[model samples]
Target: MVQFHKGFPLELGPVEAFRPNDIQHAAADFPELNFGIHHMGDPYVDETISIASRFDNIFLILPLWFNQYYLQPYKMLHRLGDALLFVGAERICYGSEAFIWPHVQTYIDTLATLQMPDELQDKWGYPEITREMRENILGKVFARGLGIDIEAKKRELAAA
Candidate 1:
């Protein structure tokens, strides 16, 4: 339930702060609840990444601002490396900070260097990105994570 933004940093300021300790407590009490963090929780990228690594119920979306593309490639790679190694490919999803900027594709393209998992990226990477990764990012993980019967549901909905 916390939304941490970088401009204000440590202090939540006007924004709500949802600490992991609190999240852990809530999950312990109500194990059925699903927790999701958005825009990598803005300025709390490192902390958010850490939480995703530790919690199975916690999911995150990577949007533009948190990508921090302006930083050098090595710095970007290092942070991205931590995310992939700790969070696992299935737990992470890609999203554009669309409407904030028109050329959001450039931001997503920066992931080129992370060399994400070969299974996540296409054979050659870049322009040739495949349907498998595309499906995973678009909705496969979400459907599987939520325990939805994707094929059966799709068929049922289509017939209705």
Candidate 2:
């Protein structure tokens, strides 16, 4: 899996930041690998969405985006709408860059409070973020992407 973070281009140094075409080419070149773009590619959210829409193996992880939860919620919501509309909830997953930002519970709590506004939901033609969708984004989607059978694992643990 490949994780690309272009949110802070300056911190990335001379790398010139990540672009959608880069992911497009990589996905095309290596169809077997799963690609995950972190922070939903932040400032490049639309591009990320576009790339994800085209590539079945590409996924978006929400880590820094949640860290900025309170600071810029509207922007996050906007990007969330675009991603949900383009790729559906199954292709997106939640992540916590906990090693760098240790307040993991705080991020989880903030994410729990997020709800797509009714107006935006209507505008985007997507349903409200249901509990099932939230659960999928938090774990099921990622597990499925990795080809892990969560229910089977649970059953095995229960049998232990």
Best by TM-score: 2
Error of 2 at 104 (Å): 1.3
Using lDDT as the measure, which candidate wins? 2
lDDT of 2 by residue, 11-89 (tens): 6465446555588888989999888888777667787889999999998888766666577776778788888888888
Clashing pairs in 2: none
What is the Cα-based lDDT of residue 63 in candidate 2?
74
TM-score list, all predictions: 0.59, 0.86
- For candidate 1, give the lDDT of residue 18: 38
What number of backbone clashes does candidate 1 have, counting pairs of residues 3 or more apart or in separate chains? Answer: 1
Error of 1 at 114 (Å): 6.6
RMSD of 1: 6.3
Q: State the C-alpha lDDT per candidate.
A: 0.54, 0.77
Q: Candidate 1 — what's its lDDT?
A: 0.54
